[model samples]
Target chain A: MEDTNSTIYALKTSAGQERNVARLLARKARTIDGIGISSILVPESLKGYILVESSTKIDLRNPDLKVQHLRGVVEGSVGITFDEVKRFLKPEPIISSIQKGSIVELISGPFKGERAKVVRIDESREEVVLELIEAAVPIPVTVKADQIRIIQKEAD
Target chain B: MKACTVCKMISSKDHCPSCGNPTSDNWSGLLIITDPEESRVAKELNIEIPGEYCLRVR
Candidate 1:
């Protein structure tokens, strides 16, 4: 499990049954009062584990009847636990507009902090292809759209 | 230069309509795909026929 702003814990289960546990956990989480299911990324691997996204902390550590019931659902040993789902939920920053001739500053790359003109925009992937005017080669470059900040044009 | 959506090439308008790629007004950042041969992104992404490419287009 990944360790980031979100905490991801391990739940013991038979090999090749991680996906089943994930699905069952999602269902159970949904039924739990005040626990809202956000997203799940169940990879196709025995070592894989379920990812549950929620704002409030969950009580999956109970070793009582709920654990046995969860195990029965999977036909194997099971214990509901936590995994780093916060990384998956980390929000991507937003932007307003990207247009031609707009001045921008490169946030990352060999030309980090350098300014360039916005010649084209790829809205789908949220990246910008820029042409370096000050550089000797004046070559074009591509970078994530969030990497740049629009330079507000001033009155001529 | 009118950018070819598929090829990312900057060419004269009404000519060189990128025969294989896509075109759209939604392109965000304009980047020249210079040195597509040496560029890691170009090689990994299999982008050929260099030109202006939208870095991020909706």
Candidate 2:
């Protein structure tokens, strides 16, 4: 189980500068004590915001963290939970999570050792429509869900 | 089971099949990278490949 901290806060920063701010905070955290920074993240879909995990309430006004670069934190949005962040985390591949454009290597079947990309999925049938990536001509082939191993996901 | 010391990829073989590095059973973190392009965690870790990775391997 993950530790729970009530001091997690979200800070607004310059758009496209979350990475820089995170780096700065990490450096600053080494110098400070009592309030140590744990996790830091900048969601890809969101701009101008970064989540910070700390042991205690951070004095945003403190100059050590260089809060000048930070605009303001999201009030009432503190106490960020790991469960919340876990949702944004990359989900491991499962049978149902497989989708179109996912690259897979056949684990068992006539095309064993062959690599293919998912073109479609049949939920009721628990089968997938695959296109052989190495084939001279793109041809769609149907296979059972358990026949292939996921290489790259469609989301990637 | 063993973990690759190089890429932190978990594999049963003696060598890491991902990077061909030697494998060690001592490892932690079952990280899965589905999409590297839009994943901030992926960018932070400098991982470009979509596969299973570990946070730490020793």
Q: What is the C-alpha RMSD of each candidate to the true structure, in Å?
A: 18.3, 11.9
Q: List each candidate's DockQ score.
A: 0.02, 0.06
Q: Candidate 1 docking: what grade?
A: incorrect
For candidate 1, the TM-score is 0.29
Tens digits of per-residue lDDT, candidate 2, A37-103, equal 6555555545788776666666777766664467777887346656666644443324587878999
Q: What is the DockQ of candidate 1?
A: 0.02
Report how far off residue A86 is in candidate 1 (Å).
20
Per-prediction TM-score to the true structure, in the order listed = 0.29, 0.44
Candidates' interface RMSDs, in order? Answer: 18.1, 11.6
Candidate with the greatest lDDT versus the true structure: 2
